[model samples]
Target: MTGSVWLVGAGPGDPELLTLKARRLLDEADVVVHDRLGCASVVQELPPTTRLIDVGKSPHHHPVPQDEINQILVRGARAGHRVVRLKGGDPFVLGRGGEELRSCREAGVACEVVPGVSSAISAPASAGIPVTHRGLSTGFLVLSGHEEVDVDQLAATAFTIVILMGMYRLPTLAPALVAAGKDPLTPCAVIQEAWSDRQREVRAPLSQIAVESARAGLANPAVIVIGDVAEGV
Candidate 1:
């Protein structure tokens, strides 16, 4: 009989942040296929007999493409292995969990998603910035910084804007928001490696955050938050 697949979220690089379900699944999985951002401590918890596969990707470098990863998951399930597809942050929040789920179903595999805390919110929260607050932010928006997005629309929203994978594009993104009518002095912050011991953060106005982040030597895998909520503790 074929086995099942579980798309588990490892939760923003902090093992303690993992849900009980995710941790239990990790312990029970016969094989764990994980991404680069997965918590080291959590991955280390796997039994010695559990098979491991690394499919981590870096900016502009995909050592294992998505198609190949999907194939691997399908193959593992067909082989009757209880497969765990471990991802950093919430699988549904820009983790491509939906795509993987669709692939598994197409291949006749039984699969389930176990949600985890997303870095989009947790990163900023770790820096003491609330994404929303009463009378401050009524809502929040999350966007991927990897593609061309409309800064004008984003600037026009009343929601706090959170950008994941945005470190590399801060120069263009910051200026675009300003040009789109957002206040140049709008509060902004960048948080790197949130929830980890090496985590770092930088706060500044919208116009200067890109420059401030550069001075701090922030890199990818960081989250950028913009709006009044960014100014709050």
Candidate 2:
């Protein structure tokens, strides 16, 4: 009675953003291992029979470590339960789906990946800013704000820069860009909780994004867009 595992993307913050396959998998999953950023509506709708495991992690804290999460998935499958590793954003895009996938394979558990819309593009669009706009930007770069960011590389690129999990680093992001040769007046926008009711945005010059974002009291689960397309709100 051994079961299988699914690495499903829950999309940004909105439940409606979920793919049909993701919804179908959720309905069939006997166990769901979710993150803190996963949509509440989706989690709340799971049948009472569904076993929910909250392995949500934040920048400063991780209630469930990665090793434990991997073990939980493998153990659940071995016990004959359909397991779903529910993550926010696309599983491959900074969601750490790769590690979990490798874990399942090593444990001899069958696994499948279902992709979802990434917040890197969705968050900016939620604010009417395109990551790449004809003359505005021909390309874009997505980076992690939770770890070491190469400010010099960022300053040298004209490509639109989208940074995820950057709220805590906002205070230094802009100043570093300036020091690395980026224009102080470069347009920047911070989108908080994209596609949800709590969604809010802060638009400012590169030099002022930190102060403006602070004034707005923007918190985690945010996307920071830097480019001409994000200018003027």
Candidate 3:
């Protein structure tokens, strides 16, 4: 009676951005395991017959650990329930979808992945900034805001840099980039609560982004874009 698992990306915080395939899977799944950041709107529209489970994790507060989440999917599938692991943005893009996919496969369950639009690109777009442009930037790099990164390596590249979950790190990130030779006046924009009703944008130069964001008191569920293309209005 083994069932299957689908690692579906809910697409940023906008249910409207959800792909048709993702929507179909959600409609058909017997159980949906959703996260806090992404699936709030989508889950609200789920049919009552479909069971829901919250595995949402926030900055240091994880009620359901990774190991536990893995077991939840495996167990649900083993019970012959079609388990859907719904995450915000693309599951592969910093969503830890790979780990969950591996867990399902290792446990002898079927698994499939459905990609979603990541805020890395959409967030900047929401702020009218493109991560890549003809002359401004030809490429972009997406990095985790929670992890330690090499400032020198980042400074050496001209590619646009996109940082997620980095609101609190803004105070140090901006200065480090400046010291590493990245232009102090590199155009930067932070999209807060992107795609939602409360969405807001903070535009500043690399050296002043920290102070600017602090003054605005911006919070997480944010995406930061740093590059010439981010000449935000």
lDDT of 3 by residue, 1-233 (tens): 99999999998878889999999999999999999997899999999999999999998799999999999999999999998999999999999999999999999999999999998988898878888988789999999998999999998898999999998888988899889899899988899988889999888999898889889988898999988999943
Q: What does candidate 2's lDDT look like per residue over 115-219, in tens digits? A: 988999999999999898887889999998888878898899999999999889989878999999999989999999889888999999999999999999998
Error of 1 at 149 (Å): 0.7
lDDT of 1 by residue, 1-233 (tens): 79999999998988889999998999999999999885566898789999999999888899999999999999999999999999999899999999999999999999999999999889988988889999989889999988888877888988999999988899989998999999999999999999888999899999999999999999988999999898865
The models' CA-based lDDT, in order, is 0.91, 0.90, 0.92
- Candidate 3: worst 10 consecutive residues by lDDT? 224-233
What is the lDDT for 50 in model 1? Answer: 92
Better of 2 and 3 by TM-score: 3
Task: Please report the TM-score between candidate 3 and the true structure.
Answer: 0.98
- The regions of model 1 sitting more than 4 angstroms off are none
TM-score of 1: 0.98
Candidate 1 local lDDT, residue 216: 90
Instruction: Report the Cα lDDT for residue 153, model 1.
Output: 89
Which stretches of model 2 miss by more than 4 angstroms? none
* Model 2 TM-score, 2 decimals: 0.97
